[model samples]
Target: MENENWKNIRVPRVSSIEKCVAEFDITQLDVPSGRFRIRIYENTNGKFMGFTNLKIKNLFDGYPEGGVGNGNSITEALEDTIKNFMENLSENRILNDSDFIFVNYNEF
Candidate 1:
């Protein structure tokens, strides 16, 4: 069967803000004009590996033109996004279940 998109995955790591941060990245993402930005924070919970907190910024400018823009390459964007996702999963559960899943979004 064709794989489903990640946005529809409904990540269950939203329990703690820290987990959310780990599941997403900001620096790696393009970061549109007025979109959410990914954020990774180092928490001292010491529950798992000390470091805690992670987030991904949503960058999506009005898709007047299209989804493809001139900023970061697909490899770079995917790398950062997947990095955050992996770290979060490792800390908790569901490690890279959607890593291979390619997801694309645009601002409307």
Candidate 2:
């Protein structure tokens, strides 16, 4: 079955954001004229691990854009997110909403 076929697929696992940043392709999938969403979550062990994750989403559908960024701080995380977002956009891995890019910050 098509569902079973997916189970047999072996995808490479990235243990850290550093690895993702190193392997990300710097290509723009489309014009950066559309809007997207940025969700930030503070890592509980962020200070200890020195990293955090950032999620980018499509405002229209509220679905993630498949681009996660790891950074040393909130600002750094955002920078990384944008960098990865651009690459994902070029690869057509992310969708454009052209509506608005919402920024949600949750206090932890």
Best-performing candidate as measured by lDDT: 2
User: Tens digit of lDDT per residue, candidate 1, span 3-78?
Assistant: 2232233457654322212323334232222233332332224122111122222224211111111113334433
lDDT tens digits, residue span 6-90, model 2: 3344547933321112222233334333334444444334411111222345546666444556667656666676667666455
Query: Lowest summed-lDDT stretch of 10 residues in model 2?
Result: 16-25
The per-model lDDT (C-alpha) reads: 0.30, 0.43
Candidate 2 residue spans exceeding 4 A from truth: 1-33, 47-65, 92-108
Q: How well does candidate 1 score on lDDT at residue 108?
A: 16
**What TM-score goes with each of the models?**
0.22, 0.39
Q: For residue 98, what is the lDDT in candidate 1?
A: 23
Q: How many backbone clashes does candidate 1 have?
A: 13
Q: Quote the lDDT for 36 in model 2.
A: 40
lDDT of 2 at 65: 47
